[model samples]
Target: MLHLENLSFSVHNNGDSKQIISDINLDIKRGKLYGITGPNGGGKTTLAKVIMGILTHTAGHIYLDGEDISDKNITERANLGIAYAFQQPPRFKGLTVEDLVKIAQPKLSNLSVRKRMRDVGLCPEDYLDRDMGSGLSGGEMKRIEILQVLARNAKLAIFDEPEAGVDLWTIQRLVDIIVGKYQNNPEAAAVLITHNRNILPICDEIVVIEEGRIKHHGHRDEIWPIIRDDIVCQVQDTCRGEEII
Candidate 1:
């Protein structure tokens, strides 16, 4: 389980402190998938970074199971079975897909690598030797990033905008991969930071954040109806400016 108590993060912007995440609290359980959804710039990504130790929280405690990891760095958190898939997965100019996956899990076998590639709807023969640079599409990069995380089999995994820049078919495939992996591992947990309504139904819980604060958090059945209604309203009243991804 992961528990965050009054967690907050602030940064100095021109000598004035700006809070990106403020006094947030959450409890995420193992063997479940948790969905975090909100408008862009609502601090959903920042909160994920704090939990993954990519950003140090200015206040409060982060506990994984019963261990306090508030002061841990990104690498330390990763070593403790916490993994994060970034909104924009980094490009490795000189590495092939297989090379990068091997680096992510050095002990991973070729067969396992191929299987993961296939699971993400990529042909291993076509992609295993492909460079991890501009050659791949946004959807490809996202899947490869997800494959790396799944290969790690981390106890807690966080994926930021997993459905971004993908078509409907690709989104469904990505959802299947994420949900299947989490469902298969009873000791592991997943946090998905997504605006895609398709991903919400698979979650055990839904957390809604706005302006750096959680507006609602509860079981999926209880919270999703409200969220779904909001989405419908937003669509009906839309007139531009980045519709939810």
Candidate 2:
């Protein structure tokens, strides 16, 4: 369970201030798969980073399991069972898949490493011994990053565009892993930041962000139609374009 109250963030650009997020308040329930969707630069990723304490917020509070975590550092938040997977996953220069998995779960053996890779739709034989560096492709890095998240068994997982750069085949597998693996686990909850419609169906709730603010939050069925209508209306009116106002 996570709650963000009256959150706001801004940055200085060429001596001018630019607000990235404003008055964002949201509550994510346990064992639920929540989707954060919106047009580009809507602050969805920023909100994720704020919750993970990677980016310092200019205002408001963040609560994890009812306690305030706005002041916590990334390691502190991670120790509190909050995990974040970035849009562009970082490369580990010297680590191998086996090494990374071992780091996440020390008790896991080689067999478990293979199993975990299989679970994430990767070939254990191909990836288990591969270097987690430039040798691997972006998609491979992404999958490995996700595998690490799963291996950590964190209480709260924030995935920023988990489907990005992954092929359709892997995307389906990733979706299945998120829904079938984590969504059903009562011990953890997930927040998926993506614009992909393929993931919407499995989400328990869909939260739409626009211009750094939460514009809509509800069940998928309840919010999808509204989003669909809004898209149609915007396309019909060329002046509005695709901006989620």
Candidate 3:
């Protein structure tokens, strides 16, 4: 559903260019969920942002369904069936949960909107009318973040650390929602930027991005040992409580 060709992004600081992502050639197929993980400052989030047009690529082309969207802006990409859920969700002081839901999917009935909230482990009575600002916890805001993304029903969804601050119940529901999105749709796919072990095993493919480039990319079973390595699980987050770090 999405193709990234020779993609690269760099930033200029003190007249020196520092590369964040370089020569990332990837094909994200429809009906598949891709898991992306790596160390900090590894360009994972930057690559995702570049795809969403939040950051302009220094070089290379981004194609969605065979059309070049490299030059498109954030709104344009979103309108073209792309959705992104941030690692750190944004704050909107005045907008209630219902308001944001309406903005994402105006056609959803009030009942449907509330149902989505419940799907994310949020109680409608307590959160439907609550402000999306300081009053809401990080986990709450993250749930709402995924809620809006899921509401868009985008062809390609990019989730940057969707499991960051949520409880187990919400994470489980999130896995269900994400996996269900492209399971039967031949035209939908997802890119998950995460380290949660609960999410990695189910992915059709796993990608490891390190030092501004893809270090390893392959089927899950082929790369599981490479990721686990020795003691530590190598992954930062705890995984199934068996050999958690």
Candidate 4:
């Protein structure tokens, strides 16, 4: 439902330009779980930010559902049903899960909230009234963050490494939500930037980003073995960023 055409982004400092994303042409479809992996600073996160309008692209266009959104701001993009889940969820010590969900989707009912909480392996009875203070573990916070994003009912979701700081149980829950819920829902699409081997194999497609460009992308069965070992960012000379055809 999202199309990126010849997308390129760069940064300028002291009159010197450094390219971060280069001509990244991609089509993200509904009901597909895409896994993005590459070396450090390979433009994976940058691309996600660009698509979410957090970072503007220097050239090319971004179209969502046939409408050009290249010039939309972050809030505008969010309104357009584009959601981004950061590597680290924000800490809101005084807010409860129910409060957060209400803020995310004011029209949502308590029944829907309960269902979403259960989908993420969280018990609404136990978590909805709890504070998001230091009492909540990293896994709990991450799951709640995911829940908030899901509450948006966004058509396209970009998750920047959901497995980054969570425990194995949380990671497992993420896998379950992606495999069970995300895969079954044809109304939305999700892009995940992850190096976790377990997460990679479950994706519908694997996209290898290197040197600010899409190096290789294909079905998981075809691309998994090639990147399984290299997902750790080996940074070999041959694998450095370059726009591969």
Looking at candidate 3, the ten consecutive residues that score lowest on lDDT are: 230-239
Q: Tens digit of lDDT per residue, candidate 2, span 119-198?
A: 77889878787887778888888888888887887899989999988988889888887887678678889989988877
What local distance difference test score does each model get? 0.89, 0.87, 0.90, 0.87
- Cα misplacement distance, residue 223 of candidate 3 (Å): 1.6
**Cα misplacement distance, residue 206 of candidate 4 (Å):** 0.8
- Which residue pairs come into collision in candidate 4? 211-241
Q: List the residue pairs that clash in candidate 1.
A: none
lDDT of 4 by residue, 3-106 (tens): 99999999999999999999999999899999999888899989998998989999999999999999899999999999988777888888998999888899
Q: Judge candidate 4 against the unseen true structure and give its global Cα lDDT, from 0 to 1.
A: 0.87
Instruction: Tell me which of candidates 2 and 3 scores higher on lDDT.
Output: 3
How good is model 3 by TM-score? 0.93
Tell me the RMSD of model 1 versus the true structure.
Answer: 3.2
TM-scores, each model vs. reference? 0.93, 0.92, 0.93, 0.86
lDDT of 3: 0.90
Best by lDDT: 3
lDDT of 4 at 20: 92
